[model samples]
Target: MSSRPWTILGVSTFAQTAASASMSGAPFLIPALHHQGLTVAQASLLVAAPVAGVMLTLVAWGWFADHVGERVALMAGLSLTVLADVGAAFAHSHLLLGICWLIAGASAAAVPSASGRVVVGWFPPHRRGLAMGIRQMAQPAGLAVASATLPAVAAAYDLRTALLIPAAFAAAALVAVAIWVVDPPRGERTAHVATNPYRGDLFLTRVHVVSVLLVIPQFVVWTFSLVWLVDGRGWAPAAAGLAVSIANLLGAFGRIAAGQLSDAVASRMRPIRWIAYAAAATMTILGLIAGGPIWVAVAVMFIASVLTVADNGLAFTAVAERAGPWWSGRALGVQNTSQFLASAIVAPLGGLAITHLGFGWTFGLAAIPALAAIALVPVRDERPLS
Candidate 1:
């Protein structure tokens, strides 16, 4: 176990954090946007814009990563994202802001799709689960930072100033990756090797479907958590921000733990299936208790939040392994594309449902996708080439 792998993991994690900052932090901007006169539904669309951008370009970036390499793809993506973030910070109108966020989303797609390839390439199968888990933590960790800081920053100054936070992160990540990250060595593939992973395998298909289904609940909860806390439960803005930040922080740990669990059990599907079941159970419970006491609803939401995102590392490890080194980037892109597509839908739709249906019914409806994910996920794990 050389320190090189860990170094790659550390740098990649920072890169992911930077890449994801804008979209993950978008929720934190909602309160300020609401104050600026956007309705919940409109604000939700703002949150969904970047994700929509990511959904659109994820596969292309993944393909680029596979064709070129992780380092180049990551550097290019982060650089573009930084420009988008800066443009977003200065945008005067909602339309301009949304366009900038859309660009940010498109560019940031490079980080997750490529970063996963980096981890899979650098670490062995035995240790890859944990490495990937740590890598996966970057999303929630970025969200956690945004949740904790962005609201207050926006409150203190303005939305534009707060937007610079992600820009700074993107710049820092660009520097880190440019200097430290390198792609692992690749061996020549045989002429008979299949380049397109979707041809004969149902594994990637099932994993992608399950991940897409699972992301609905994840984004629904994430996009509206602060509003739900403040408006639904009567908490102050700062307190709600703190609660969501804490949940995201815990979600990061959950990713790491879920990865280690897969490694310990020597099966990726098991942990993912377990996460789906757990997500279903928790989300169902959340619906049941949605109108209950504030403390109780908060507790249930916390559980649902943690369980919803816990499957990322597990499913990602499964996908990367099944795709092998050859198609890992594109496969991961497809996987994330599906999930982000689901997420793009979840944000605005969930917000609309919350506006019309109330949190109780909306949460109950959100649980349906988690239930679907449980049925969609494969029962057994696929074996990967060493």
Candidate 2:
């Protein structure tokens, strides 16, 4: 079966948007819970539970996509996500909600792994940077939905009903995957290698290091950016949420733009060298954002988000390119595993850093990872580091 790149792109955008709504749901839900008398700390746990669940299953889903096709995994994941949303809607206890969220987290993870595999499979090498970026945009686009609707829904109606949007969206994606998703012909791929790859050892391979290090900053921003806005800049939840939403919207564009730019580079490093540099420069600017006015800080956050997330596709292309067709799934699996493991640790650590150090340090520390990813880039062709 031959799949259109655009069709796979559509699947990615839709599925990611739906799953991303869940990512945005936590911060949005916190406000609704605050109105219900829950403390900010307590409210965040509701979201965190599911995220932890997602971290646990990320690698598993990657392996699954490597073995099965991206289409099958996406269909199953989205269907399960719909069901999990139903459970989340009904769970009265925080414990049950945590469990439901965990289930949702694991299921939601499938979209990233599956969506990415589809893009890498459908597009050619020259087109992959842009294509993967387009695919990565689904994240911020999805966040935009959460930002725009989640607060209003939880406010006007109950939190239960507010979640229905993601549920319905997931259901639609299930059908879309069933009907629309297909693998491209082998002839369409840029370079054909093995048709099967192993999952266990993809991590120690040189190229996978970029995937590991890139997530350090990604998790940092994702976990703490809202906290910084509210605590550091004194922005309200509505304002903070909206700012984050806007940042995500712009961030989506950044992914596509950065992807295209990365592809344009002639270096064997492709995006790694460039992305590493951009991430450091941008995050450094963001750390300095604390002294600026709120609106400016907001803009900085948006821009930083763009830089932070830009590496999403470029790194994936490296994996697919280096690993060959058979290894893409395992490669992606390792990528997801490392990124989310960092995410799981970083998310809570972000919260802790705010309580201990000041807000500036929260963003400032991310530079460490940005530099690390850059350093990981091989300086010479076929050198050891890459």
Candidate 3:
């Protein structure tokens, strides 16, 4: 009870988790829409809003965290996100839905920036890897909640209530952070200094490169898995949601274990490389196997989810360590920006891929990024480009 900021971290984690869980509603959406008589054109636009919203503001949030400090950024963003979520629930027009989702996407950035800053600030350099890893678990945990509960809630109650669930969750995080998250005191002069990583000799050039490379599959599988399960394999939304939820449960543990392994191993990238290799191989195999049987496809995706995401913790830790303290926030922000930017692209492309190339070949293309990430793991710290 005394060490309760961690619980605050837990709440912060929940906010992010809830935001991510929103994708679960994607698969359930059309059925709920039958009552509204939404045309394909309108449904497409609404489905695209959250993805667009997240991409639009992710960089802004990162920049703010790099300059202003995470606590202020997180509180501000969380407040806006709560507003966005609640307001979206009541939105009656298509235009309002898009506007609400865009705001929600933008607001969601606050927690990651602030929470990451907290882990970076409090944890020592060596242990920072593990701390950051623990923080990443929020995503999978949130995805699990969305996948497991959101659709069911929508079916039993209504889509508005389902949307409200995550809104309330984000609100809880806002209140918890307000009460519990303590910012490290900086000298009046150095407070701004702590926010940016550009000044130092310690900027992580290799870490940055690897970060951009690694985020591809994580983003791909994350954004595509449920849609792939439902569209490609013909699984019901409820079933697909459950499968992704299980995959996310595995991912939550994978984040912690990857971080610990990064600290314990003599070489940080070694285990990371192995995880990348596994993800690539799994994707390739699953992509080829997708046409064979539904159960087989389901099993393959679940396995691929585990292998693909296991490296997220190690990746963040590597960037933080390589950047050192002065540059950690900015370094991580750059890392996130690259990855999430890719995530932004992946969603629409995935939709197009399913629309055009069919899921089999599009999924096969995703494996290419995983393999590229695996190949890059051999690179060591070259001189900092910065």
| Model 3: per-residue Cα lDDT over 1-386, one tens digit each | 24654665565566567666442234335435534676433454466566566656665676677567767887898888888888888988768866877778767765665677666666655565566677888878887877777666766788888778768877787777777777754345456645444545433555555565666666566666765766566777677778888988888888887877766664467877888777778878877887878778878877877777777766666665555555555666666666666666665666567667776776678888777766566445432212
Task: Give the per-residue lDDT digits (tens) of candidate 2, residues 1-386.
Answer: 23477877887778877887664456556567657776555665556766677778877887888667787888888888999988988989778977888888788888887777787778777777788888888877887777667666776678888778778878887888888788644433433355443334443354567766777776667656765666566766667777778878888998898788866763236566777788887777777786578777767777778878877766666666666655666667677666666666665566666667766777888888888877666535331212
lDDT of 1 by residue, 300-323 (tens): 888887899999988888888877
The local distance difference test score of model 2 is 0.72
Query: Which structure among the candidates has the greatest lDDT?
Result: 1
RMSD (Cα, Å) for all candidates, in order, is: 1.3, 3.8, 3.8
Candidate 2 error regions (>4 Å): 1-3, 23-25, 33-46, 186-206, 266-270, 379-386
What lDDT score goes with residue 369 in model 3?
77
Which pairs of residues clash in candidate 3, taking residues 3 or more apart in a chain or in different chains?
Answer: 17-142, 197-327
**Residue 371 of candidate 2: its Cα lDDT?**
86
| lDDT, candidates in the order shown | 0.86, 0.72, 0.67
